[model samples]
Target: SQELEQSPQSLIVQEGKNLTINCTSSKTLYGLYWYKQKYGEGLIFLMMLQKGGEEKSHEKITAKLDEKKQQSSLHITASQPSHAGIYLCGADMSPNDMRFGAGTRLTVKP
Candidate 1:
């Protein structure tokens, strides 16, 4: 597809539930960046992985870049409503050149 594809464009989960979102691409991702955007807010950096097989975590969310550089995943453990937002995975070809997935909107139910 030569484009980034995100799974579960929208999701609803219980406050304490665990969930995972996936991102895949047709091109080799030189780098992968994860960002979160709350409703009506700008994107907030979550993490970035320039090396394959790299995994990073912020609070309750953990993201991993597969060795293939063709896929990545974000895992949320013991989610809270505060965690609800749009999760975006962008593929970076260079420092300022990045392409984003449509995003996965996560809704954590109270």
Candidate 2:
């Protein structure tokens, strides 16, 4: 929304490829989150970065928050057809305020 911004609003990857998406904020982030979803489905939490310079990985996915707490990145390795979907990045500016990106649409070519 207003507090968060994401880049490269969309991406396309070939099967077995790797890709990265970035999110940025103007204010310091209290918490940063990554999510994945398919059409007609709910969001699935991928990872959360609470501290600056923090990073986490699960399976072929990895997330990182910059030391400034103003940026975050999500990386996917060896993407498959199942990886094709929408990716979202969220920022919690305060306990009462949370904003999400418009979402990056990812399409994986067979």
Candidate 3:
């Protein structure tokens, strides 16, 4: 079975600082999905990457998939308190099998 690993299980940053979270897969990834979860709430869809070397951005957040398709990173620029939450990375191993990372908890201090 393949697994997803996320680094820096937790993070704390000052407002306006930049931070990045990484996710690595035990096997090649077919597709990757990024999500944000607020405390006591369900996960919120962020973005998805399917191609190697692909990158996407929305507002201050950016996501990139490595050319090897085994890793992905989520970057947040100019952090804000509103950005505090848990970030999760999910890998689509197959149509019937999806794997998720442990998740990175982010705390943005004002």
Which lDDT values do the candidates have, in the order given? 0.91, 0.91, 0.94
User: Clashing residue pairs in candidate 1, if any?
Assistant: none
Clashing pairs in 3: none
lDDT of 2 by residue, 1-107 (tens): 45678877889888999999999999999999999988788999999999989999999999999999999999999999898899999989898889998889999
66-101 in candidate 1: lDDT tens per residue?
Answer: 998889999999999899999999998556778999
By summed lDDT, which 10 consecutive residues of candidate 3 come out lowest? 1-10
RMSD to the native, candidate 1?
1.5
Cα RMSD (angstroms) for every candidate in the order listed = 1.5, 1.1, 1.4
TM-scores for every predicted model:
0.93, 0.95, 0.96
Candidate 1 stretches greater than 4 Å from native: 94-96
In terms of lDDT, the poorest run of 10 residues in model 2 is 1-10
lDDT of 2 at 40: 83
- Pitting candidate 2 against candidate 3, the one with the higher TM-score is 3
Model 3 per-residue lDDT tens digits across residues 1-110: 32999988999999999999999986888899999999788999999999999999999999999999999999999999999999999999777789999999999889
If the candidates were sorted by their lDDT against the true structure, best first, what order would they fall in? Answer: 3, 1, 2
